[model samples]
Target: MATFGKYFLIVWTILFFNFFMETQAPPSCDHGWTRTPNGEACVKMYIRPPKAWHSARRACRDEGGDLVTIFDETKSNFVRDILAVNNTTTAWIGFHVILTEERWHWLDEDGTPNYTNWRYGYPDEDFWDPMVRAEECAIAAWVNGLGAPWINYVCFVTYPYICEKPLPSKCQWNDTVCLNIHETYDGWKCLKGRDGVARIVWPETYPPGSSGPIISGYALPILRSEKRRRDLQ
Candidate 1:
């Protein structure tokens, strides 16, 4: 009888969860920004009078983002298309020389670029010298009859720029489930429970005897599944 009661409780919980989902909205980007097709980040192009590389990056920071970082061919192409669509000839990206590391790196990333789209005979070695290291900044530019490609330029040169920020990852309605699973849960901080495990209060509407706080599960496959669904959407 106890086993039957537990089984019925699980079924009822799932039903209520599904009903709750029907009224919840999916995660979204801020106004004036567009989410990437793969949904990993948000991007916006600033077309005001061109600003120097540092100034442009500062503007993006003021808007809660940093200059865009292109990680691979897909992101490179996406940035190119955006520039082409905006009639922009060139724009500052986040890539810049790390003099100490002797390699180019994105502002928000630790490692050097795994993929790059350098134009012919570019990323000029001239500025790699220690004295000129501060001068080399990267830009995406369109050449006559050629696709957009990156070129190293002096940091003081003014150009419109692109800004990119991470997409919101807060679970739409599964925060309690996600908080118990990932240490980096974006929704809310987890609280220590009586048993020294992470836990959350059960929804008052759940099965009658289940109104108290519940312990974190050994695994939260539901949260993982939700993340996959969000990424795919």
Candidate 2:
């Protein structure tokens, strides 16, 4: 009986230590990124180096992902916060107005913009006149002096690109929301769920008492089955 009690106590101690380590892990990326513990699901990358739109997509694919495709306000704010932290005026994202001239859509290659986070008066496609049909692909970048609206650029032009991989589903919970905290060349910071009464982080700092709706309240669950398929491939 004495030996059994000692072994039980030892097991309990080990379990406690493991739990502590799990919760105390430091924030994974830098200001604009995160590392999910359950393999690739929790990790993501954001880049804005110049490249043609098609080229950017290819680069992401080659690197195991594609240009950034924001699915919710939290994700959008996260990316925006990173930009603000780095004082990045412009960068490229994976969206464009390809169909019917001005009909904007995400460059998903999957034929759907199921998730969208467009700014006011977006998808204007003003840059493309009927004559400019050939230049349909779009890239996003900071338009210095133009505030936070990431203006579309011709894909052929070289710029940085961001890459992302599905993070482990274990790190995510149905009841929790995630927000981007900060970003740097190394990685980014994403906070999960609201901490108590604190409002969700807004990429655009809002003035006090000027509340309307802040977050767009959309969530994109990383498709686990899709990831499984990729892993098998």
Candidate 3:
């Protein structure tokens, strides 16, 4: 019983440490960018005078992209990576309250508010417009440009637009499968078997077929079960 208690305590301590480490880890990237071995898809805009939200959208559209939309982990990581790399505290994103109050939308082909990555205490109507009932919104960098933080800005104030261009796909390989490492993408690569041996392939050199350690920066390795192996093959 004492031994079991000791082991339990050890396991609990390890779990607590892991949780703290994960929580304290630095943010991987900014709010609306993604990273890839090939390159990065960034929310690029100028640091000129302020612009309204609509104007900002137009500027991004003109550049073959929209303001910015972080729909998933890939996009989120990409943005975080860009911000960290540039040491930028904040920047503009593609989100604004359009017809409805507090109902944000992205100024892109899909003008829907599918996802949001706003920081704490955001979308505040600090600067109100009597003429417009709905509060206009735009991404602001460095919190009023005073300090290095994120803030929401009123639309109609002209600022440079940030755009996102899709990155081209690259070839990726995994222990069990070969996948097309395209931009804006995600998928699994391997699975485990009942035997406990991870069903991974390290292809033999100069054999019947092209085989080697599947290596693609984008490709992920996974373990497969016997049943999955048959189906995948």
Per-residue lDDT tens digits for candidate 2, residues 1-233, read: 99798677656744543343222232244344454333232323344455667776787777566667665555666556555666654556767765464555765555666666544566556556655655554443444444345555555776655555544232334323343322222222222444422133233444454332132232222233645433422
TM-scores, in order shown?
0.70, 0.47, 0.42
Backbone clash pairs for candidate 1 read none
Q: Could you say which candidate leads in lDDT?
A: 1
What is candidate 1's CA lDDT for residue 83?
Answer: 88
* Candidate lDDT (C-alpha), each: 0.69, 0.48, 0.47
Question: Ranking by TM-score, best first?
Answer: 1, 2, 3
- Tens-place lDDT digits, model 3, residues 1-233: 99798677656744533343211121232444443432434356444654566766677677666676666555655655555555555556676665544456665534555556555676565545556565566553543323322356655555554567544222122122222212112213322222323223233342343222322222133323556434433
Q: Model 2: runs farther than 4 Å from truth?
A: 1-49, 100-102, 109-121, 137-147, 168-233
All models, RMSD in angstroms: 9.7, 16.1, 14.8
How far is 110's C-alpha from truth in model 3 (Å)?
6.3
Error of 2 at 44 (Å): 5.6
Highest-scoring model, TM-score: 1
Give the TM-score (vs. native) of candidate 3.
0.42
Quality of model 1 by C-alpha lDDT:
0.69
Whole-structure CA lDDT of model 3 = 0.47
